[model samples]
Target: MTMTVRDLRPGVRADFEGFARVRHLALPFYLVTPDSLVYDLAHAHPASHFRPLVAEEDGEIVGTAQVGIVHDSPEPGQGYVNVYVHPERTGRGAGTALVRAAEEHLAGVGATKLFAWVLDEPGNRAFAERHGYRGSRSAHFLRLDLTNGTLPPRPPLPAGVELRTGADFADDPRPVFELDSETMSDEPSDIDYEFTDYEAWLEGTWHHPLFSPELTSIAVADGRPVAFSAARTDGGTRYGTVMTGTARAFRGRGLAKLAKADSLQRAREAGLTEAFTGNDARNGPMIAVNKWFGYEICATEVRYVRELG
Candidate 1:
């Protein structure tokens, strides 16, 4: 089989579907489709220099890599090259070729450091180590059988607090965006991200095809969105929480739990059978909350970093 690595033509519909296929096979939780992939590439910030790479074996795409500079990071020259190969297509050297192409692309674009998320499996970890990447931090993907699993009862809302769907903020999503920005700033990670671009958020997140506004739950405290559980759907029985966080001032309260519970309950009611979420291994608080909701770790990934030229 002849394997070659090249840039994915965003204008090509097949490229979008192939990329989404590889990602869905490699990372089962994250909901993605051709529409979402095209939307992401179209809305990606120019500063990011985002280039999607694909590996083709005999005219069939088997692997993909999303390579880009972390333009929003406080530290410059930081970039990322996340590679994913179709599970059935492994051992064909597609991953290696794609990684080489992505690394070269980022390095040529002035990247001084590169990060990649590698599944915690032994083979995946060994592959990253072979590419000079060292494990930095780890995170877990959790799953809950919403149809069969019982969710804890919703906690009573605090005084002056209200529960609302993300759709309720359709007229002015700035509050939810602001709340998300604040909570995301405090999220545990190796990169220090600065999310000051609300327009970018709207383009990449709010308007994304899979974002389920009706399924997302927000906790409003005194007319302000204090906590939220943003949801994404696979347009089927699968549902996932893309982001769940509480504002700094709102931590220690049960708002996050309340929001997640409300979201999960509604998802099940809407016929969603499988629920997925993620949590940083070091984030004990959030992990505890997920556990309380009966979510179990289904897979883990480690962020691998390497200093580049």
Candidate 2:
């Protein structure tokens, strides 16, 4: 069975399902659903030129890639192509085919730089190095066994601090949007992102199929959101923290940890058996918070960069 890469068929249910399946198996820490995949394809900003592709072998999708230019960046020619091959299907040509196709698409769009994330395992890193990519920053995947772990019991809310669920802001999520934007801007990343487009956030995040507003915790102070831990569910037993952060003013007050704990407990009560989150290796405060939640380091991936002509 020969492996081949092609554009994802957004209109085909099976195609999108297969794509989401491969991504979940490859990066179990993140949440992906067929609906979310289709929404991303259909609602992405025109400037992004975002294209998702899949590598198929014997009618099975064994690899996936998200290829696009970094349209939001102030600098031009920056692009990204994060590819993941099914863990059980490595050693095949699927990964290479996906990479080649993504590179060609990005280069055609005049993207002069490409970024990717490879597992920190020796073989994965070596494959990236062999493909003309250089290693850079790393991030970790953390997992907590909600079915058999001792989570920190919810504590008393601090003076002047109140806990709320993201669903509380269903009437208007702009406050949450503003809070998210403030925290995201300070996050460590190769690409600088500015969340100036509220409409885009609404379509891409607020209404995302996987977003679990009921399980998402927010800490409000004086009626303003100061910290948050966003939740995404697989609509099954899996729960993932999509983003956990606190405004600069709220850092070190244990507000982020409190929010995460609240979210985790809500997820558990909702029958979620497993929890997963990703953290940049250098983020000590957030790492400590996850550690407090009894999360263990499950895997690591290093970011890689390639200069495209």
Candidate 3:
């Protein structure tokens, strides 16, 4: 079987569905849909040099890669190439072909350092090592069964604080953007990011096809949002918390937990059966909060880095 690598053809229904299928087979814990795939390709910032590639065997797509530069980071030359092959299609040349295409594209865009997330498995790690990538930090993909599992009761609102939803900010979402910026800056990651562009956030996140405004929960204190849990739902029963964080001054007050709990209950009430979220392994506090909500680690991925000549 001859394996060939090529760019995903935009506006092609089969290509989008095939790409999403490969992603779902490789990473079942995260939500993947054709709409999201197309949306990302259309909305990605030009500076990011985002390119999605697919590896095909015969007439079927077997692997996918999303290669792009970290344009939002203050540091330059950092790029990422996340590759995933169909679980049953491994051992074929699909993965290697996808990686070669991804690395070549990223390097052509002036990437001096490349990063990839490999499943925390022996074979996956070996593949990265063979490709000259060194393992770095790891992350966990956690899942919660909202349909059958019991969620914590919503706690009473602390004095002077009120619970709100992202829908409340429809008229003006600057407050939500501000909260997102602050919390994102404090997130644990190898690449430091600054969310300085409000318009960019609106286009890339707030208006994304999967983002669910009604299920997202926010904590308001002293007339400003101090904590938030952003929600994203596939046009199905699957729901995910994209981000849950509290402001620096609001830490240690259990506000993050409160916000997440509210979002979970809302998701359950809205008929979302499955919930998913991811966390950096080094983020102890958030992991504890997720554990408190009965989220269990379903899968783990290790970050792999390689320096390009």
| Candidate whose TM-score is highest | 3
| lDDT by residue for model 2 (1-309), tens | 888889998699998999989898888788788988998899888888899999999889899999998876778989999989899999898888989999998888899999998889998998899899999999999999998999889867999999999899999999999999999988988888878889888888889888989899999997899999999988889999989889988788889888999999988888899999999999888888899899999999999999875
- List, residue by residue over 1-309, the lDDT tens digit for candidate 3: 878999999999999999999999899988889999999999999999999999999989999999999999999999999999999999898888989998889889999999999999999999999999999999999999998887889888899889999999999999999999999999888899989999899999999999999999999998999999999999999999999999989888899899999999989988999999999999999999999899999999999999998
- Sort the predicted structures by lDDT, highest score first: 3, 1, 2
**Best-to-worst TM-score order:** 3, 1, 2
Pairs with steric clashes in candidate 3? none
The better-scoring model by lDDT among 2 and 3 is 3
Off by over 4 Å in 2: none
Q: Which scores better on TM-score, 1 or 3? A: 3
Screening candidate 2 with a backbone cut-off below 3 angstroms (N, C-alpha, C), the clashing residue pairs are none
Off by over 4 Å in 1: none
Report lDDT per candidate.
0.92, 0.90, 0.94
TM-score for each model:
0.98, 0.96, 0.99
